[model samples]
Target: MTAAIWTDGVPVQGLGLMRLTDDGWGDSDRDPATLVQVALDEGVTLLDTAEMYGNEDIVGRALGSHRDQITLCSKFGVYRGDSGRHDDWYVRADPATVRTAVDGSLGRLGVDHLDLYYLHHRSEETPIEETVEAMAELKQAGKIRALGLSNVTLEDIRRAHAVHPIAAVQEQWSLTQRGVEDYLPTLAELGIALVAHSPMGHGVLNQNADGELAHELSRIASELGVGAGQVALAWVHQCARQTQGTVIPLPGTSSVSHLRANVAASRIELGDVDIRRLTAAV
Candidate 1:
């Protein structure tokens, strides 16, 4: 089977659960069944999550070996409280912690193995080599199919890649958040895919980017006749494509309609003129 562009060796769509809070944006998100159906209908096969999201139960219920067909990605290294804020986060790359976390995730997700697993964030608490060692053990033992890392520097990525072949790197990269640009060349050189999580800048470029994002999104939105969100996403996709790795932008919403709009951005190819305008302004 062909692995997905973002998943390294796993096949799927990456559903970001960071903002799937109980906000009544629409009917689909409140109901897991509705969310799964909509995603399947739209051919969005990769679903993403994390232990911190507190919705793995819903995902485990929604997936149901249908997970075998869908590529589900997730991350660890961040701890969540009842309120879903990062309170007591641990960046330990210890083997025991990794084992315990993966077990908890598997139990909550109702699955044997995650298609792709990433270290949620990197810090000085644990060396990248240690983290990579623990991750390699997990992959060898079948806890996850592939390994990935998030919020890592290029040097950290290189060290981890030395220990194991990381499938993808998850980061906050959008037309609005272009921090990943500084390190993308290393990714291209290493053959790892980039999963740009918030291509819409946490809904800023589409909803409320302060100044520059606002101006650029408005112009692109008017030209595309789609929406600011769509335009911002398209710009990220174009950049990801240019870098030669796949762009998996996980823009989450409670509404099925909005999720469909996010999917549409993948198909909305911007012209050179449009790309030039958006790229230069940002």
Candidate 2:
């Protein structure tokens, strides 16, 4: 899938709804319903959610009359483990589970189909090809428009892509976190887009925190006459441009002001020297 094919007119910045349901991140005063509308109004058409987020119903109600106006995305397979810790989540992508999960997601989201449906995590007990084959069946059944993979290895991508064309890969990538950079060449070669989740270091890069990258972002942001968060987004965009792949920074925010600011950040451009400086600082 080429950048144009995967993006398909979706903006370079998207809205992540994980934070909407997480009390640790979102504002207690902000309503998730209104945040969805604000995202559409800002042209952030890529609205991402997940079964794990536990807010599909809220997102569904919020989308309301404008569901057709955005590329609605969701994920499956990830389930709570015994410990129930964030890092202890488990995955199950058997053919039976895949069918049951999609139906449940559709019911919760109040939609007949999903624009993009991702296998949230690789299953240790199941083969990637089998999981993707099940997803392809869903696409054939008109349940999902495109297939995506998240938090998957490069080998997983190759094996899954062989079964079905992968439209995108969702992972964490930002100025402060660049592990996903290693996958850029392969993703570009495959023509699969990279949907960068937590592209702002999960809000650390935006705060006035004390750190080398923070200071550097502030310095470059001051020179560019924009906020540091915008600089971070610009770097992600420039990095994607260099790789010749579609990399949409999916940042989440319950605050309307923060959402608007992030949308505005999508347009900030950075020079080569500043890009290098920010790249090196990280």
Candidate 3:
């Protein structure tokens, strides 16, 4: 799939910025600017961030004059209290909330318009149609170029698509976390891209991976002379290839070495047997 088809011409392999924040992924102290530059240097230009990450300001600062070189993406509606605790999380997709959130995101990212904007999560109280309608209005006004949905149901995609074309759907999917696989068919049928967040299964498919999954990943990575994380990323790319759809794995890392490794994984092609073994092991 061509990048333009779904990612606004940015490469299908992306970088998730959640790890740059202090909330998770122990690399908060690493320079965010250095990581961003390394990612851009390696052609991994689809940088995904969210208001929830509390690092949009860091990402925005890192952008400098390179905004046009990458696909600036961020999410809204899924929020938490000022305490910044995950336990205080909530969702709000009211039209008013949608309008306010995008503006705030824009100011933080220092961008006039977002290349892709996502409703981080569907609000239980707000109708999907209403939220999408407000997002469509944003597109019409040029506040955002395309619309996306994250952590949404297949039904939500259908209803939202009825109101507007969903450019992509971001979901957590990996060898260890395959729940998002159930929606791949619908996503492919509609020509909407799948942005695989946490494509490493939140570290479960990396060095931290255990049990049979870890052993199998180690064997494959050893044979391929690559890291287990790269094998996992290759599997994600293979998934998109099998469906003939775009699957951009947005792996987050604050380390420059790991950033380059993740981008390099996009080029690693796993053989049919290796792919099968990895699948069965998971």
Per-prediction TM-score: 0.88, 0.91, 0.92
Q: Tens digits of per-residue lDDT for model 3 on 1-282?
A: 345433446376888888675333234446677777778778888888998887888789888888888888999998777787769888999999889999999999888999889999988999999999999999899999889999899999999999888999999988888898889889888988899998888876778887887988899899989999889988887776787566778888777888878877888899898889888987
Go through the candidates in order and give each one's C-alpha lDDT: 0.75, 0.84, 0.84
User: What is the descending lDDT order?
Assistant: 3, 2, 1
Per-residue lDDT tens digits of candidate 2, residues 179-271?
888998898889788999987888878875457778889998898788888788778877777776678888887677888888877778888
Tens digit per residue, CA lDDT, model 1, 156-219 = 9998898888888888887657788887788877878777787788777777776765787787
Whose TM-score is higher: candidate 1's or candidate 3's? 3
Off by over 4 Å in 2: 1-8, 22-29, 208-210
Question: RMSD in angstroms, all models?
Answer: 3.0, 2.7, 2.8
Backbone collision count in every prediction? 7, 0, 0
Worst 10 residues of 3 by lDDT: 21-30
Cα lDDT, model 1, residue 97: 73
Backbone clash pairs for candidate 3 read: none
Query: Which predicted model would earn the best TM-score?
Result: 3
